[model samples]
Target: MRFQTITTDILVIGGGLAALKATHSASESGMEVLVVSKGTICSGSSFYPLMEALGCQAPTEDPEDNIRLLEEIRESSFQMHDEELTKIYIDEIRDRVAELPAMGIPYRKMQGGRIPCFAKRARDIFIWEDWNAIRNKSYALLKAKDNVRLMEHCTVIDTILHDDHIAGALCIDRQGSLFVISCRSMILATGGFGDLFEHNLNPSDVCGHGHILALDAGAKLVNMEFIQFIPGFMTPRYKVLFSEQILGYCTQVNDAEGRDLLARYLPSSITSRQCLDERSKHGPYTSSDISRYFDIAMMKEINDTGCEKGFNLSYDPKLLEDKREFISIYVDWIRKEQHIDLLGTKHTIAPLAQASNGGIVIDVRCATGVNGLYAAGEVAGSLHGADRHGGNASGSCLVFGHRSGAYASQWAKSCDRQAINTSIARKALTERFEHHRPNRIDADELIKEIRHLMWYHANVVRNERDLVYAKDRIRQLYEDFNPATHMSNPKTIGMAVKADHAARLSMILLECMLLRKESRGPHYREDYPEKNDRSYARRLMVQSTADKDIEYRFT
Candidate 1:
């Protein structure tokens, strides 16, 4: 019950590229900024640098190229993106990307010019070859700043609101100690909820707790149904993201039963070679193309066989022999970093949860509609809708990360820090951990259950029946959860809190998926099976009402 109170002008929550960029921008305002992360600073999906590297796309110097890039974004996202935000991204991305070099984070520059990835001709992307160097330099720069303070191994329990505005946050450190962080403004750059699934490429702590925090603060989350699933290794190296670039070279794919996986799933019109070629052009699974069958087959194999290790996939190195440029970079990086020879290895592949394109809705300025609160990066929604462009993930992090921090700082400077009441946070915490029930749910077990439930029912393919089952099961799990019984061990407290957050988020996400009732982007319903633009074109938004009920509406 004992807690310490800390006051700051701004509070930034997250540990990834977005959080670090926000911190850097906020520090410029000369305000007292406190960054709290569940993990170490510079950790999260961005640090992982999947595929070729952590790709960041920006507009080329040519004006026509920029226009084409904008068109490509709209086309690629299935016209589901916010126009205003998309324009802002295209216009400001170049400047934001330029800042990287000054921060000592060097990117690969090919001889000709920008390297385009993920099937976009107009789009030019820069890949960071050395993510560790970027992480170290980013940390060093932020640490050297006088007004910024970084707190690691700290989990934010909930957002504290006063008069329906951001006041502070309730947090707990790695130890059992509690801290009340009062700030004029708070930024949620806490990445995505990929960790909520049974299989994901995200770090252990990268659950969508930030989405729940934003909802609690009365912010609406948009496009919750659009989750990006990528092909990743299920064995040899579990959850290691398999590059889509190399997917084209996959000569054979067979399930444990020796059944040809792709051949079994592909439609009569599409050949295995054609599917692989189309699938290789993009990373995330999309209903927009025939390539979707690649991920669909993988998911189906896992679901049908209940094979935890997924299917065996073998690649032809001879296919890549013609493309030495790719071999030198991607193939070599895999060999050096992952300790895997892509050509020589026969690995198990499955549809792994990669990122969430939909999240807490933010405007052009990255404001989350709620005062004193903002969101950026993967945590912020409406920026990328349906299917996101390949490099836009890291690009949006920089563009909106700076926007959120700068705007939050500007807003913070205009107002005085409000006195935050800890009663609400305390009450919720007590309700969560105060129960003395002898029979209590295990947080770790609950999380595993939730992950399996999500992956099986809600991931890749969904129908009303499966989605409803997921929703009911999540509600049951929530009712059964009693964290107080496990309070004796402080380490488990964070896990317990995360489980609760994941359950709440999972319920909302399921509802959104169910409400859409149409196939669009990553949110494909097997029952619907087709995109219905007339009925379900608009983005779905979810928010928490005053009565503690979730409200959903089409925007």
Candidate 2:
């Protein structure tokens, strides 16, 4: 297949808030920036509705206090993050939040004039709106800059490397058009791999494509064992996320037996009602919170029931009746999405993989081990370690996006534009086209198989035996599955690529899980049962050697 080539100084491989911030910052440095996204701008996980308040941490007055808070947050990961990088992430958000108003983005303030801290004591800013305003305003500013260009509906398949440095990237658009983005530097802002799980909150397209790309290019990944599984709605068919606020008001009961399940996991001292009341103040599962046991109970129930059918969430109808405004807002969504009255009826709930706290290994400047390559946002790893606080996800995106952009721009400006790497581009393009050939395996079936295996073994509750079986199964699927068989349709091609990414990412994640022998934070190991700080406290790292053999280490 023929291909087109575009040259730029910096190539940004996402359209989320992090990518936009990077593009805008890079363009301001007088460098030409090109952004390529699988979907439309702001369509990544940034705008996903969480059914709870979403907060972004800004800078606080005291650096030591910020460090202490950040350290506490990283404790969820068992203190596996790089302290310097963590400092950069928590420090840079203050100025970034201050700059939001000038860009037409509003940060809500508390009545006492202090920023709200939803999940932690750190100052966090959030608004009633999801992310439409910030996304729109950021895109407008990017579009206004003459040097910044955006290519939507474009999926980057691979990163083209010249020796150790990034030379360019190969991408395919929705129209099945192939193109090459030749640049001096590349930033991987593609979000996490939540969609790798059978039930996830991320969009369908976020299947760890960036992880596979970086790994294939010999970049190291750390803390892959930590993925967050949050309580989510499944019944009423609305699948609306029931945030901590909503969970507090509901009673957890078995869907079929109508039995209270909290007693199975929580101590006798804490009643089910008390657990629900205490858990409502938190959003996701944090290792430090006593409510995490609630999540463990729900997940244990899910694990026992084969996870096909969800559990029951029953709330007092009078609660909604007391708050007519809340009911009025939800009634419309209930009718439109599920055609059922959610207040009076029992809804199904399950633990769904929501966000990943692990990703590509990067330094304090957000530069990966590979020269001229940078990772920002959720795509970059080692910041959150095992568990992520609620507001830190967006805050890290802005902090590192700004830092990575400036560093990448400086690196790009110092280098001379090299000739287009036609050989690498051609090889990558040919591999993509081969998927369309006849007599290949079905991508849909393979993807479904991968998701089921991951959700069963790699998520929430993981054991050594299950992880080993999953790793072998994923490897076998990767060996037997041929992408070319199901590539007749454009949509199938997309699914085929995502399936490929999911398989590779699963294998890597399994490797990380297997190496960490003790249970820590979100990387729970049923076999080990407890955290072993003596030997497993350090972060685990994995990389592809020149011979393609995987090497593992602890930093």
The best candidate by TM-score is 1
Instruction: Score every model by TM-score.
Output: 0.95, 0.89
Off by over 4 Å in 2: 50-53, 59-64, 102-104, 110-122, 128-135, 267-270, 286-290, 316-342, 421-424, 428-440, 483-494
lDDT of 2 by residue, 1-555 (tens): 556889999999987768877876788899899999998887677767544334475545766667667656665456876778777777677777666565445667432222221234535445334366666776677778898889998988778777778888877798887787899999999999888888878787678899888988878888888887777768765446665555545755664577777777888777888777767765566444467677777777777777556777766655555343333444554545456565656677777887788889988778888888998998998688776666778888888898889999988988866667566677765554345334335667777888888887887677889999999987877777766554444445566777777877888888889999988777778788688988987888888887777888987
TM-score of 2: 0.89
lDDT of 1 by residue, 319-422 (tens): 55744454456777667777778767767888889999999989878999999999999999888879888788898999999999999999998888887556
Highest lDDT: give the candidate number. 1
lDDT of each: 0.83, 0.74
Clashes per candidate (backbone, < 3 Å): 1, 4
Candidate 2 weakest ten by summed lDDT: 110-119
